[model samples]
Target chain A: MTRRDSFLECEPGVIRLFGAADIGTKGMVSGWSGPEEGHNWNDGVEAACAVAVKPPVTRLMLSVMGEPYVTRARPAQEITLYGNGYRLGFWRLSARAETALLVALEPEWWLERGAKAVMRLMLHMPHSVRPKDINDGQDSRELAFCYRSMCLRPIAG
Target chain B: MAEPALLGDLRERPDGSFDGWCWVPGRPQERLIVDLLVNDTLAISMVAAIFRRDLQTRGYGDGRHGFVLRLPANTEGLDSEALITARERRSGHIFGRVLRAAPAVSAPGGPALDRVERQVDALWQDLDSARPPPEAERPSQRLRSAFGTLAGRLRAQAGRAPWPDGPPIVLPAPVSPALTVAFVARAAEAAFARIAALAPGLALARAELLVIDPGIDPEVALLSSRVRNLRMLRDGAAAGVIAACNLALAHGAGERRLWLGDTVATPSAAALLALARALAKAPPALWLGPEAAISFADVDAPLPPAVSLPARFGMALCVDRAVFAELGPLDPGFGAAHGLAYADLALRARLLGVDLRAVMEPEPPTGAAVEFAPASTAAWALFRSRWGALDPLIAGA
Candidate 1:
């Protein structure tokens, strides 16, 4: 079972990913599988994680580096990202290679609950599938993307 | 010297609205006047008169001592990062918690889209300026053109249908109607008959029924004469359900507006009275009723009051006219997919801190499931373009 306390900050604000620095599994609140050799797969249709941020910052840039579980049968996967409750951005990944998804978090979203708020990031992937259901493999866990890393950088107002 | 028994709290909602309940313990019957201060400056004052069942059940006089203040449009950009506090006017007491206002987010597409819109307008203006002027017509040609216009008008008039050709037949509205039942009649005569069946119940409850129809049904004219206070709107263009509902919203002469589908079972007079009472007492909210029949245990017994509806159960809704107008009219761009339009309105209401309540009856209405037209691809795309996929259930509905 994955726990939220598994996330660790490698530096002041940077969170390293995979192999003793797997922030994805540590910070994942729900909808995720165990860490793999060098990545973490987002299980099921939705995945959420909570990231703590220092106050007085007006905006934050969220960078999610991941690769979709695309195959010959599934040519592309669409993902919609949400911060708190507001939509941050969207992407359609067609290749298996890792891609960086960057979106700016406005003050309204970062400070939604209050001045000091935990930024909750959620990803919605409707086309997620179990490998066994598609005859691709015997793996039955619903997988959409394998996350390599995630970084949050604060931008001065 | 003891402190004045001031019992209440104020909290800021996610959408910047302020809601709280306050009453002097010694004077439970009195409704306190609360002043909202932004950055230590008084912004607005309101009477705590809205009802809250919790307050009443907890020993507050009548529960009509709560207030919900919607964020004023003018205060959006001005007080984005200010401290807000609610103070009782008479006692000079302030709420314990001071809320920090969230910065106002710009409209979905933001400033870049605004710039693009301006460029598109400029291009349209440039195109208009480049157009050639029309050639001056000779006197004989002008006379011939005038005769052609006259013949076309005459032909159009001759071919016009007798039923829905002219202006809509708007009968006299009820004097001081408590509720306005509004629905779009797409099935013409069948829809009109269903609405007409509710006329007697609506009249008994001092509710006016507004029917927006395509005017293609000739039977509607005769039915209109039979029903009292039945205002008919002829949507001759068949501008779809959202547009028709907007027309009804505009023409309805009632304190509260009930947006219903023609297929839903007609609510009894007692059920409508319960809805009206609940709406009257509660703060600004969208009250939703079950699609099935709403029957009371005794039919004559006191009906049950409405309760807060979970976000997922938001389907049909009723709203106060002012609140409905404040939230803005249904986007006619949704076209015939009125369900999506209502869902959009419900979403907006939720964002603005308006409660979505379920109007409950003693015996829960049962029977046939209510039918909602599946959203067209274009309508779904339009809705998604505005709201994204924030709520999957509402989006799918």
Candidate 2:
């Protein structure tokens, strides 16, 4: 199996980023596979705050730039990503340890209008901390060893 | 990008102005904007001409700009100490540790301190005239009685005129470091011993141990003399704990001030290092850390930076000197020995847009349990009047 990578650096506190790769094979680079055809997978999309994405990414970490749909999400047994306010129910894509699929606007709604690109793709280092620590408690906001920042490219890239 | 290097001490002048120079190195092509931040608020900004002729002599002509900044006297907010920050204009991220200096004490705001006291005093007079049934009086009415009692005690104990009905005494910071680790000294010399046992050298580096000694023990006095920056203020008259803290605040040179209760053990060297590192982050206006019963930080289950267990008495109640210079001192009128003074201060701080934040300590000291002064209805009345809807935990404490 071929592996690929991308990253971002954050600072004032030991923020450093190194190495870059154009893993854009058919527009699927670093876990962000361009808009896979997804439908409303859960009932009553109204009170739902997140979408359960079955992405190829087992880990994802990035500090968002604007008020993007997914600023931060938790890595659950189902690996839940916060709904980007589009209110589209759970999206169950095939899960993997690498690659991410993130968009600035709501993906499903924007995709219906033929919007095919996300602002950035964030992929974090897999299992950097102990497995026990990830689900340690309720206030699990920090996945300490996750990647810090990422840059965006066109969906067609 | 190369980080900015701020050389020379940023000290407060007698006139209450701050002057300092910083060498900020940037990418030759990028335009850097630098700002002078007082208490995290932007006071001034300048487009950095980030280039130096000396740098050309060294090697490449990258943007290594040298800039000088000066802060004029504050004619308005006579804040005791101003937290000075040299931050990047765009990201608002500071390059290094934040510096603190005393701003010019200006009283443009109607001498709010005096006005508050007068208002409180006037209300007391109204309550006295009305003579409400003693058992049915509200908290504010009860406060009148408390202040009256305080006045009586001042007369009986010191045999002097009662405290003036003006305002709570606001002590201006007299030192340069960021904060002073202050404590009231009585018979408990073990507290000083705990502080002495730590990376003794580390404990006294960035902050000073302010022993507000009413009467010094020979061992503590000896410790003060031996330690480099240990200051034992002469409290011969021996004021109450709140008075000692206010006095310590006046004598403290740091722009920030912290009070330590003798009940808890002192912080270790690692703990001190953790504190300094956290301070480097230039914590928000009113960040606080409490003593942990455990010898180490709760790393296995770490809480967020802002959330922390409550500190009792003085589990290190740190504040920007402005807490006093801005919002008055811990109301000494709140009956001595009923130590809700720190909690009362925290409540007021939150109202002033400064909340007591929890500082995460890696090498937290042992004995987190604090013995609070027995409950005082008078203290509760004072707190409720200022801070509506008391914190249930504190109300019960």
Candidate 3:
């Protein structure tokens, strides 16, 4: 796994797309992908990418933008972007980042090519704190540690 | 103070006319005839061009020579329309108009003057009769009686009551740099998540979520790794939590300190900024925000939508380092877990003669609350106990 990539110098108003070499051979990104798809997964990725470049980004965390709904007899998460910002949550997104770059350029590459095309863009910000000191109370200390781990757990995945 | 000057004498002529010669100060020696009149119809003008021989003898008049006026008897008794108009054009108040129109009457000879005097006297009497007394009528003797009653009640209340003394404990500046968070696992997760969620926009450079991780939980480790500036101190020594928080606080480069909720939802960081700005005014002793149910407790009295008085301290408070120096640290004796520290702090602050205040902020999170029956029960009990003991003193019965 690559250690962690920063948003380095990129073109303005244009998204920087990085896809695996094996990706895009299928010409189709599975599930919900890209801006053209109503899902607008690219916009979500851009939003998260934007947050990593700024100071005070003590944590790189993600939360679904909206509630979930039942689609085709199965429960699917409904996402809305840019509402909190001027064009909806866009301000909320951009204000957190110096700038954002959409990570995915292909829509159906993830499903068609399997593992080769699978690219996960995670926020590469550092954790807010680390255990600086270890003191008394063995059981209670263990309890607190357990609680702290629970706080960082990803609710969806 | 100089005594008031006596009115100048009026000279009477053999023809039953009067020529009054008053010694008015600061006047030129020139004999200037300011008015030439035979009756009520008179024409008056200043004459430098008038060639009078006696006027040339003194020779050095700068043309500011003042002179007397000749008038029909009882100018005070005349219809005062002209005087009233001139006064209205000058001062613009009703009092001025009246004064100018009714100049004081000193000449007492003509029947017309006597009649005008009677009319003025009757009007003055009517005004005086309509006026209320200068002071309201009050029962004077009752004041002493009231004070005596109050003193008796105060003595009764203080008969054997013990109020904490000893220069009230002052909160010391923490010698260490850390914060202690005493909470359960789920509450701990919620607290970290809330802070993390707020971090992106909070603009806060230094904030650490020191979670108590028991069992060396990897989830806790993973969560800790996700956020920058977060430290998990495994030993859940409640005092250690306090000690750790003190450490973070001491080391915290930020200008302000905040004690926020873990599981409890909070307003946006902007909202927190708004609160910090409000507290920056360094208002009275106690500063608080809206949505602090801790202040509400079980009091049915419906606290005013806003009140700035020293009272309970709860979640989400910002205080300067000096306040802690003046006040003191949380009494660790409250317990290993979060409990009565706030009440103890508030009471101690009061004993030290510091006034507390609570101000409301906008857009606090709703529906997310910690239901502490024990806290409310204790708060209500304390209020009643204090009230029962001090009612007579407050009432001055």
Candidate 4:
């Protein structure tokens, strides 16, 4: 077992870009949805950014579009970020993830599956924050095969 | 197996009496005791006999019991609201509830009937007049001799000038019978489109639509103008809905003013007319539509018809222009800055003794006017500063 404090080395602006989002008019996000169609998950995330992003957010690079949780159980550990010129790596299903993870809806479900990866996020600090213990509906072997190659820093004993 | 029960329809008799059937079938036909209550306080208890009809097609009970009560004349001059409560002799518990608010009348005939009679009398007098003019008078201008009143009308209009600021705000016009529907249009296109579609029905009723568009492009204003009887005002972006609504108030020349929004389902022309008609019957009131209205009592509880005198902000409301001016303009600060503008207006209206009334409809809305919620911390601070304590203001009112 490792000390909780030591396991996390936090920095300012880590969760600055991410925000909590509501269902909001079901796709009435700012000028994003097509004339006929309502907003989908991707558009919801971008539109929610207006209310979600914390202030001094004006200072940071603004991205209407962003990637959130797991995509095919790829671990989504290291994310290539842009605009803000800062790379944001998410630690999904971590012990302290509740405070950071945005709950788009109740009971951990999202408006759209892709929305799970857009609005809810937390910083990935290697082995300190572990992936979800339960099967995330992805092929388990892919997670096993991919995690082996990455230089995953182990938790201190 | 059998307990006391109040069953079936409650009907009223023309002679100011109530006729209804109630009985314990196959039981002893003895002293049938029942009570008739008016306004839930004035109770008139009576001993009745079983109304004989058991031998006919047997209904619920042995159709042997019924009562005809000659309700005392409304000499006390109380509002025609009566509650018919029947308490069984055996149990003494009121079995059912029946609410009736009889219409109040000015005279033997309705206002329209009286007006018609007056016009006919005038016409008869005009027909028998000694002096005959070259041209006949307009029916609308005079009750009798149209030719006699023609010169008077021309002289009146000629003497009167236009509004100092701009053109006269002509609402239902001289001939329009339709009610006027007015709303402040924000950035929502879906809301705007819905109102636009209702224009034809409104025109059918001779109603006019006044749309106030603030800080929007020229196209929105242009689109709204094409509708018949619909006038659009385009104020620059700096003016919020509160300011635009004030502008609409200035130009709204209807018999009564109705405030609505695109967020709500547009009521039918008949329903809108019915609402207007209802207000005409009651005392002058601020008719708050059943959307998001808060109770005068517990702010947390729903604004039930029984307790809530003047409901808080509902999505749509209708007020007379003369009455509205007396209440003063809605505070722009709460609306623009905190988004609590309607609540403030409601409170102020209550303070000024403006009766807040509810227009009943299924699925009442909470009147969340803005597109999004404002930051809570900032909103709360502003609300407290403007409204010192809510409980007392509500309690006092």
Candidate 5:
């Protein structure tokens, strides 16, 4: 008897990729567009998802593979990742090529906040742009970066 | 452009309860809050956020848009022929056709049910026959035998007295406990410490802690004497965790039972009370712990509302004594793989059309020092063999 609901909750160490018809909506909270061909675009200035990790995990590596929506008008896209309200890392993407953002999540960020089970990962992108506003296309939805996959693996000592 | 619509079915179960899935095709990600009405009168309200495998496979975003609601036994105007309908709580837009309640009926013992039962029994027999013969002397058993021989020789050479044997200690029956907390303890000292920490809360809720020790550790005997409301059940034959849990369940005197893991932190008094309240109001659903761990700092924080749980995620499970008795005991065939055993129980409940939900509450942080054993290969194989056809997403499959 497979508990169908467990698949809805994010499990630690399991890499869930976006754009899969079966599991693309696993941990999606808000600020994201519908899954596309091979990726999902962050819809607005902020996007968030939740994950549950084993309680003993003191540190983890948050690896996200995606491409920023950069154009000549906006040469760079600045992205900041936050775990349970604690800023984890920041990256600046200057090209439209796929970029992998790897951030080390320290214990203080999660353990200190009493987030032992589920950690909310919030991606803040102040530079999100709507294609229509930049004269690129008629699309009106605010888009920042499109993610292909995201993984949170525990860092062994 | 197509009109946005709620598509699903709301059927009355044989027990007069209602369960079904609903989602707006254009807004699959939105979890609709639905209301159940009996004869056009509101009966119950629930969030349609339970995942259904069929819904996912059929392209209903994530499939977490289902609900199972048990109406009160004495709900006004509810009868064998009452009209039941489901509608969106916000828009009051009704979904699906009206369903007439079915009279409660005893399980059918007809040919079809009997045939299914026979097939399942045959499958189990086939799996049992396929099991490989046990090794004559495993490495660990051989090492233990050698150590025992060396120790005996040393004792004889020194003319030391043999170890003393005494009858096993029996604990008095608890006086009508409201809840039973049971777990298999791999380490007596750590289990004792957890019990000590949880004693006050257990006492406040009139709960008894049943420690099932396979080793029958002497430390546990000593600790039981010191701790109030702590009961010890020695697994004298070293029967695995599954058997130990069944023993504890049989011997427990509580109205409700909490099957907990040794490494998971015990819930506080408030959390226990919350669970009791939820169980009282809920139908025969399997209540699980939150997906996230509750740390000491957040122990006093307000609990989130209960939500649907996937069967395999909880470290703790609470069920009414009657519900457990109805569902039957955990399958002993799982051996020491208690995790799979619990998941099996949940899945079995689901097969019987029971809801699987999580009780949101602040629980103690899990102990970091102890690492619980993973499920054995044989147990996993057996579980997959039994349930793989039903659930394609069996772990590692």
Candidate 6:
């Protein structure tokens, strides 16, 4: 197995950033969802990014929102960041991936402007892989087929 | 067929008594023999089981015996009403009824022990199922129930203000000249500010800070080195005020412990000194501020005198180490850090005989009193579902 798979298996609960993440409340608007909507925003981004990339190396990137404000620790394994940047706070790693990842990396100042803000990220994979697992590769084999990707979001306001 | 046996004729003995066997119904084991004699002009029987004072006092008493008529004919149907009536009057109260004669059948051997055993067993079962005797229930049962309720409360309070170690510290008189404080706040910056403002005023040989933060912001991290006595810890919003206080207390050492709110803007340095001094003069297991008013009353003991403070006031409490020796640490089950479970501790201090008293403050500290955030509707709903009958603390007394 690759080092990434071993790392994922050894500490499946740990949340790691693909690239640099800003710690602030303001960012670009990329995706939106209703509180009750069941649609997977990350998958939508993956599909969007998947089709946008060429066949040789199909790639997808997306951001998922997390809990609001700051907490001593994050409670979930798979976290979602919105707007710009990556790395958020950490929490106890669950051997199992979280059912849902919510990101509130932006500060209260930005949150007051709108109900929420979107965290940005990048996703990449080989052309042969499926698009479904692009953002949720750690969770499913289908997404693992996507090959490689990246995501970015801010940590605080 | 053989004739059944009848009551034998009673005969007077040398002690001016009558003695002989009497047949009684409802009892199949053996026929009773009653002996009668004159005692104080009453016809007493020697054949009757004699009841002594010592045996009576010890709860064992024999049945009473008196004169009974005897039947003579062997099996000639001697079931006459007159004879039965005479027997009834003579031993009716003791034996209830007189047995009639029938054709006797000879028994092969002595009565069956198994039959007797079965009968005894049935009797015991009846006794077992019977309602408890009135004497078994006393007024003390209520007292015990109340005490149990109070003990449960003490245990819960002990849980809210849990001691770090196995049990609370056992302190000697004139408590080892020590002080411990659990400081709580939302932002690491806010907590650091409180410590900076508080240290200069609290003149102590040693002081330690257990700071809990939700997120580790750079600003939060900056305060780590600012206070020499500070040890920073992090937890979720759900970890709560009482929980953070307990964690801090676990990491600290002092003869007396206090819960200092981390977010409070102003530090009442004088109030801390006054508290330290008040505890020194009149030592109780737990000390609180007289002005620290709790609007909640105990559901069990409603309107408990307001003079006493609830154990939840750990925010500024000075607990004697000895109290912890008797009761253990604060309970994490109360809720995340500033949950409402702190009030329950006040009830415990009272029930545990730890003497909960409020210190009168001549000059009160200045600052908008920090109160816990209001419980969410969902939180309130869950709390009521879990502890509806138990929660006595409410707003406006």
Instruction: Please give the fraction of native interface contacts (Cα pairs under 8 Å between A and B) kept by each candidate.
Output: 0.00, 0.00, 0.00, 0.00, 0.00, 0.00
Task: Give the candidates in order of lDDT, highest first.
Answer: 5, 1, 2, 4, 6, 3
What are the per-residue Cα lDDT tens digits for candidate 1 across B1-397?
2434786766544445767778887888885767777767766666576667778887888776767665446653344334566788878887433324233233343344435545755655565467633557334346544543443333323332112333333333344467778776654446545654565567566677777766444333333333333455667587766777777775565778777755455666556655566556666666554431222222223333443321123224577767776688888888777766776776677678775543433333433122234778898788777766664433453
Q: In candidate 1, how many Å is residue B178 off?
A: 1.1
Model 5 per-residue lDDT at B231: 53
lDDT of 3: 0.30
- Say which candidate scores most in lDDT: 5
TM-score of each: 0.34, 0.34, 0.28, 0.33, 0.35, 0.31
Per-residue CA lDDT of candidate 3, range A28-146, in tens? Answer: 22222222211122222222322112121122222222212222322222223331132222112212212322121222222223212222332211111112223322322111000
Error of 6 at B81 (Å): 99
For candidate 6, lDDT tens digit of each residue in B1-397?
1232322223222221223334333342232333221111112222222222332343222221222222323313332211121222244333211211111223332134335434755655566467443445543445444543443334332221111123221111111235665565554435555665666436542333445554433234334223332335544443666666665554344666766653223335555555455445555555443223332221223213332223222344446555754555655554542343443455456567666543323322233222234655654454455445553333211
Candidates 3 and 6, the one with greater TM-score: 6
**On residues B143-224, what C-alpha lDDT tens digit does candidate 3 reach at each position?**
4335434432342222311121122211111212222122222233444545455553244322223334342222333332
DockQ of each: 0.01, 0.01, 0.00, 0.00, 0.01, 0.00
Question: In model 6, what is the error at residue A127, expressed in angstroms?
Answer: 79
Chain B TM-score for the candidates in order: 0.46, 0.44, 0.36, 0.44, 0.46, 0.40
Residue B6 displacement (Å), model 1: 38
The candidate, 4 or 5, that scores higher on DockQ is 5
lDDT of 2 by residue, A1-157 (tens): 4443221211121111111211112222333322211101111111111112222222222222111112123232122333333321223223323233343333342212122222232223222223234444453222222221222222221
Task: Give the better candidate number (3 or 6) by lDDT.
Answer: 6
Worst 10 residues of 5 chain A by lDDT: A1-10
Q: What is the lDDT of residue B6 in candidate 1?
A: 80
- Alpha-carbon lDDT, every model: 0.61, 0.41, 0.30, 0.40, 0.62, 0.35
Model 5 CA lDDT for position B397: 46
